[model samples]
Target: MDPGLLYDLSMNDYLNFLCVSGYNQTLLKAFSGAHYRCPDIINIMDFNYPTMTIPKLYGSVSLTRRVKNVGSPGTYRASLRVSAGLSISVKPNVLKFDKIGEEKSYKLTVEVTSPGDDEAFGGITWSDGKHYVRSPIVVGGVRGVFHVLDKTQFIDLGKLHQQLNLEVRRKRRSKALSQIAFVGVLCQGGTVDCMK
Candidate 1:
């Protein structure tokens, strides 16, 4: 089976394939348990990538804000917070709308301290003490620390089967041997290799 299929296959599909391929019930159960133990792959779906385009590190972008209120005037403050490996500065962080239909523009500058495959995500929040609004700030061309694993490696059934079998055998042997070795001794009563 193609390695790509491992990533694309749902849990049910994977289990069904295993069953159809003549894998015993015990092996199927073991595979299911191992699959559940593996950490979930992080993907772009895990984070909010706003549609708005942000500049690369050490670059600047202009953002416009317009306030329209037919009833009363309010003061709003703007602030920015970025993820690690990035810094942000907003030239006029605070905005005051003295009247209705007031609009303003600010220059936002970003600096990247570390270059790597990690995503930089943050938000620009505007608040008037009574109400608040936020816009997503995203820095592209970078990946986050938690990222999708390489599906190619994940889909290798032969390697996966070998690992599962080894683990199952180790577990089965350890339980029976521990009782016969020593009650409370290091190396699990010599069942485990402590010197090597």
Candidate 2:
């Protein structure tokens, strides 16, 4: 979706953005005095924009995503930023590749331990210092531990927060409709809302 979603364009069952940047820093380094021929491309795996719902808290919730490097092999760093009322983390904070097109799995876990009753928001940013790619995340306020059968659907993890209480309140269950998922600008720098 790097150049597809308009945030304005509606694709098949998914939102679109005019442009997106999963931090592919090729042009940004081209002007350097030294010869820069390597391409550092960081891609978010199976990322669905707008936002994703955990469905149920049940004490803890976890998700996995795959990120692959299609450019020159190098090391890319992964960082997480989340909201309150939950505890989120990712495995292997530092990613390295010996060859191109290599992929890695990121296991993100979330645990709700606060009684704040406020929604949680955050994301995981993969950066090579120049290009910063962030997948935004927002977790709605929950009320209690729940178990709903047959309501199965999930997406990738972005941001995170909190990690203390096991007595999490269940969130509201509404069947209105899923949110319109859309990607923002494929920015290739620091954390900020951007589109181009």
lDDT: which candidate is best? 1
Please state the error at residue 93 of candidate 1 in Å: 1.0
Clashes of each: 3, 24
Best by TM-score: 2
lDDT of each: 0.50, 0.48
What would you estimate as the lDDT of candidate 2? Answer: 0.48
Please give the RMSD of candidate 1 to the true structure.
Answer: 20.1
TM-score of each: 0.41, 0.46
Tell me the spans in candidate 1 whose CA falls farther than 4 Å from its real position: 1-51, 55-71, 142-196
lDDT string for model 1 (1-196, tens) is 2111001224754565455556776787787875332223332222222223543333333443333433246766877777877666776877676765455555555555665545678777666776555667777744222222233433353356566667767778654443331112223223333323
Q: What shift in Å separates residue 134 of candidate 1 from its native position after superposition?
A: 0.4
